[model samples]
Target: MRIRATVVAAVSGALALSALAAPAAQASDDAVSRADIAKVREAAHAASSSKAAFSARAAAYDEPYALNVTFSNFKIAKAVKVGTTNRVTAKVTYTLTHGTDVDITAFDFLTDPFLYKGSFAAPQNVLIGDDFGHCKSTSATKATCSGTIDIRPRDYELLNADAGTWKAGAWAIAFNGEDPGADDFDMGKVGYAEKGGLATTLVQRYSKLTVNASPEPVKKGKTITVTGKLTRANWEAFRYAGYTNQSVKLQFRKKNSNTYTTIKTVKTNSTGNLKTTVKASVDGYYRYNFEGTTTTPAVKAAGDFVDVK
Candidate 1:
């Protein structure tokens, strides 16, 4: 059986290169100028620090935590229904201290809903893998590429936990590492706190993942089975094949519809296929689209579009 993807809805910012950033001491409390913000944004774009990677014996670290994570281009391509699942995407970047205990392991950047039963000193976030939530590669590392986390529609619950109120722009992200040994670095801790130097009060904005949906102009209102293919064009090999969760929701928007309505949703089979089918409801000049998001090898667009008749 195929499972639905989790839907993520949040607000966050990303890197944008401009000539407004001025070098200031890390310890200084001066106001951040537009130029400084642009420089930081440029660095975030250059490093691609948010994507996932694989590492065998990379550096490790401990103690005074250090991670600088920035997420931009936040959007919700296809929002999840009351019962089905969906995906969300965002750009991420970060910097951390390297050491022996700081085993820079690999991880899947997918996001999922987690339950915390531990106290503040020892909080525990567990991903409920029932749906297409929080699925990624186990061999991901920092040496490969920046990581992207895919959160399901229900994963927002995990981000909202441990807080008293749910603010409009406040959110949290947890990274689950690929290491399992006692001496290895903790994936969950590294992802949330150690891996990306972000404030405990983090925020993410919503962006759109456009899926082209169009019907054959000649064969208006045709009932053909439409198949769409999604692939990572600008990602490393390990990061590309490591993302086990490729499920997607196929949707359609009529000539003048304002919102995307979900027509069908499907989970990728074991062979890495995020395939789904839907019947055409509109005639000529219709739009066919798919809405999805993830962290591992973040996919920008839903491949290409097709014409139906």
Candidate 2:
């Protein structure tokens, strides 16, 4: 099945702030007093506490600044076959209207797969461009970024195990003041924007099937044996492994006819092996059809012909 959906996140209003600039003091020739050193230590502790509080607020989605950022042209793969080395690339264009003279330092784009209870697991952050150069500003107000993240077998397994929808979105961190570690810089002056409505898609996997019918020519009343195996992708090992205890349909197509009819339903054994018997009556073809589960896609094996004399 093919899925196409887009979710948009819009930002309204501008972020504004005002603060007083610290006056530079002249150098003193005398040694500093112990009381002055204690005051400096107290001020440093206060700054650390403020930074922690700001981080807590951002985590809770209560950031005070309303970033004037817009995201567009975000794209992601609809589905990926299960594999440890599999990866998905997400691309997006963004416009930052932070008035004039505001430079964006860094940003992150993330994907969060929702759980069965309709909440999100920990988000996976994508790597943006080469050394984060893709986000370089084309102008003062706009920039385009593209990045890819590995989708490990564990990610697919989680989606398959949970059988739910997954969401991809963007989060941005913009710095307006000096570098973070500077004594004159304040963490509260930073801008944080998180926009979660981008794209939603399902995670699906592929299954493998094989079938064979022995004794090409048999007597009219002879018992014919049909054998097959059912297996699926083993993402961790990057190989196909047996899928046991799954129901599959045995089908037959008479020669010179355009249709295949279900003969009987059979289940795979512990080794994903199948063995069934049918009476030879006419010249026809035999095959296996898998209806598939939520995590796997439906598949049908090529027909094997048998002739009755």
| TM-score winner | 2
How much does each candidate deviate from the true structure in C-alpha RMSD?
A: 19.5, 13.5
Off by over 4 Å in 2: 1-66, 70-78, 84-118, 121-165, 173-190, 197-199
Q: Write candidate 1's Cα lDDT for 1-309 as tens digits.
A: 211112211111121211111122121222322233233323332333443432222312321112322222222222211111344333232222223333433222222222222322122221112321222222322222232233343433233222221111111122233332347534324322212112221212222233444334435455545443443311111122212355566555454545555566655455444444455545422223334342222333433434444
Tell how far residue 247 is off in model 2, in angstroms: 1.4
**Model 1, residue 227: C-alpha shift (Å):** 2.3
Error of 2 at 28 (Å): 47
Show how many residue pairs clash in every candidate, following the order shown: 60, 0
- Give lDDT: candidate 1, residue 57: 27
The Cα local distance difference test for each model comes to: 0.30, 0.50
Segments of candidate 1 deviating more than 4 angstroms: 1-215, 218-221, 232-243, 284-294, 297-309
How many Å off is the CA of 42 in candidate 1?
Answer: 31
In candidate 1, where is summed lDDT lowest over 10 consecutive residues?
A: 2-11
